[model samples]
Target: MRTTRSRTVAALGVCSALVAGPLTAPAAADVADLRLDQWGLDTVGAAEVWEETRGSGVTVALLDTGVVTDHPDLDEVTVGPDLTGQDLSPDSDGYGVHGTMMAGIIAASGHGIEHTGGVMGVAPQAEILSIRVAAEADAAGGGETDPGALAAGIRHAVAEGVQVICIPLPDAAFSVQGDEAERDAVAHAVDNGVVVVASGGADGEAVYPAAYPGVLAVGSVGADGALSEFSSRGEHIALTAPGEEVTVLDADGGYTTVTGSDAAAAFTAGVAALIRAEYPQLQPEQVAEALTGGAVAPAAGAEQPGHGAGVLSAPGAMAAAGTTAESVPPFDPELAEQLADDPLVPRWVLWTGGAVLLVLLAVVGLVVLRRRSADPYGLGRRTPETERRPVRGRRRRGRGRRGVSR
Candidate 1:
């Protein structure tokens, strides 16, 4: 519970999109319409993105398992990496497979590769830099967890000068804390002006980067514009995105409806890309404002705080950015439904999210308990957890001598 959203805003530097709410599964008939670009806002942002911007000259950093570099639909995406390893698409496991789907939403280009599959990229012209860190989960529901790799990826992403960084993974526990490398990387990205987009964890507790003041913490919303059960809440969240049933290509060359903050994040990232693509003149801050401010509040009494401004509407966003799209009123559920009948988001997001929240509480409890044992005034506090004296070269006060007491 940190109260300040300043850091979250700085990190995301853009608005997050809220899903229309849980959607029905697409019928076989709907499958034919399946395209990676099937995000609800796809049509709305297309004109602005295609005519004004294709995410061209922009590189979005997908800091996740990894993007499917060789996918037919991902011609525009360029593979980038961290200290961990390669950017292998169609790889085994469920880990980074999600990354490809997320990337497709932001910058998939189905041309050149035949039958690129059900998903089409949102920002077809935008490029992607892969920052893979985690491994796919095994049947036992466990895989190698590597925060270091995540930290490395963040730094690498900043160094590479990515304009947007999508962090799909949630830190294990807020108490787990981020490694120095990760914090420094985020700081560097902010200093250099990279917009960071992250998902709110299943837990109500805000996760890092997302919780971190500069990051744009995002929660999930469904087709009805109601907050998804799985979407994390609280002050850390800066916006919401279409998280349920959105279609994207998997690493295994299949199309599936996904429901996670990750998918929502992808759509949000795409929206940001659309704005940047159209209004390169708009700074990250301005881009965020336009997206959040332009979003129509969900129905009356349905609005939630921390989700920020409102659900993203690409049409509204374009208008706000002054892209000259046709003048249109805020979102109307009936009108949107008429435009497309697809299901990428589901209602179970919350039921599944409860477990996650429990874990976060445990982490917080542990951290608090540990902190109580340590000396509160300890200046030796290091990052992550526990406490320690300053590293070598640092001096401690002796008698106000103001000199190194080494």
Candidate 2:
């Protein structure tokens, strides 16, 4: 695993509204009032999307530092293996802080007393699978987390049959050379019809495995629907979500607002969960298309390079029709012909050609040796110096004593 300086944006203190006072308890008949303070809910049309599905059957895998499984907002979270090499419990305070925050953003259920009118996620009913792959020590020490652990976590999520994999960390956590195992694991997830969502880096550079093909790269946008300056920009970005000033439950049982592409990715993953629950038959690519195609255009003058399709709209995606596998168009004949004529050969063919060449060279070497051994006086061979000595002696005697002496 490659190590580098930490690039994750730390979570800021809770939003001002939550700090003012404890939320008033909702009346028994009005459960909708419980989430009135969640601006993100309304901004992304979560309430309307909830009418169709709350992501009941979808399981979103959170591959991060860890999660506070016992938090009021995260009652439905299931703690998975700790790939970070830390033996801490899922609800541990110090190490799992970042992962806990992301969990609240995705599937916080708000089940405890202190959270009665607290933070509610986009997919309030979705289940969270907390897979701890990021190391707290590495992060604090300004070192990159293990990419192998991340790759293993992705494979584990796929094996568990998760519908969505949410990586709420930045690009710097990955190696510059790109870990082949991590990339292959992500590809495996996509091939198995799993939606992989990752944060576009905060420093305006493309990041992996977000930059990898078939992954949904998310950028950050603010509540006002403008692109956040810190959000990374690139052609790989698939969509933008409300990332700035986004309120989420922290590890200390408090609400806090975070700003970065991590929050955007978590929010986008939640939206993906909603889509999966509403349209279980849709393939990963089709689900991605729904999110991108259904995104609302940003306000004038607010668009940025990484602000991909636009800001996420849960209601729009949920209401959008699902695409069947057969709906995809066939490959164009011209493109197919071009590919056939391309000089780049497949890996298997290259290996086979190399093996054939080695065999041919060995056969040629053996044939040359055999031909030389069979005919000692072959045309290509030179006569021994001893045989030519007699001829020279005859010539010298014939010439005269003076010639021989000369």
Candidate 3:
């Protein structure tokens, strides 16, 4: 097992080294031309929602490795305390790369890296509070993230009055069932009216924090609007967003693309920030419902196990009501008896209804059989022959012209 893990790390190192080449700054006009390349933003209708709110006055707490405070895209980010005990600066190189990537996806301003059109987050005006819980190397070293640090980070974010908390790292990095302390911390944040969003895991298994109640578990979708093959599948998923080949700013101030549920979760958090900023009176649960209820349905024939409510629709959510409908009350025998006594229809009416349904079914079956006979393909239905015929258009070359030219 140790040897296998070492080989995996070595392979990943080589790939990273190959892709981490120096980047050149592009002209300012290049940024404008590449606006459509931010497919994630376009997918969620971020531009329409931006007309109302760009997540102004919202603070999103990112719990992960750490962030690059100096990254031009993250100049507005506030670096929080490092709980990893590495004595690493918030903008430390190497260890905080993953956290920095997630942060850029949530709040990057497309500043310095704009040459590659840089990266623009869903909520460019939102503030990021960087809370370092673990380093990127810990996972590569075959060690799990410190559960204690994760729990502490949540509590700290809540105390700091952050409106949204994003945990892009999966719970598997710590435990299968998850750390009890971390679950409690997430619950505490929710209770305090802070929306907690977490990755639904890259593997097809339930992960912590996201699996916990009151926390929105976000899955991933590809640019084609299909569920990402690697996104975890489960009932815990609350919503999905584009994650495949998502552009993010590295700690070294370079642009790169990443694929995973983590990117989806960060984008969801940005949408949550937009909601919080637009509707300050909404509760956490209400915000979750708006996002889920307003989601755009996935494309037909797409496997939907990993996609919860479907693709995140920022404009739809912003346009939705801030409150979810009240749950129906529990069954009451007394009310049932009272309703039973006041039947809207006589008992004989039910018998008539059954007979009518049977007749309707027989008529439908007869129609289907007649249509199938006329349709040579037995498609169970019929279409006009003219409609099935291919419409022909004028040929580019006439027969006489073609022969003479030949």
Model number with the top lDDT: 3
lDDT of 2 by residue, 310-401 (tens): 88899777656344324545434356668787736887898899999999999999999899898767866555863555434344346566
**TM-score of candidate 2 versus the correct structure, residues matched by position:** 0.70
Per-residue C-alpha lDDT of model 3 across residues 1-406, encoded as one tens digit per residue: 0011101122223234337753322333444444555788889888787888888889999998888876656757888988877768854456567887888888876653332344578888899999988767435443246879889999999999999999888434634577789889988999998999988876566778678888899998888888877787877888899888776776765666677888899989999999888776677888898888889999853455778888999988876734432332333445667779966677789899999999999999999888777986855544586367777998785557655654
Off by over 4 Å in 2: 1-37, 91-93, 112-116, 137-139, 171-176, 323-406
lDDT of 1 by residue, 55-118 (tens): 7767898877666655556776666653345344444444456577678777766532143323
TM-score of each: 0.64, 0.70, 0.70
Model with the higher lDDT, candidate 1 or 2: 2
Q: Deviation in angstroms for 338 in model 1? A: 48
Q: Residue 178, candidate 1: how far off, in angstroms?
A: 4.5
Shift in Å, residue 2, candidate 3: 21
Show the lowest summed lDDT stretch of 10 residues, model 1: 1-10
TM-score of 1: 0.64
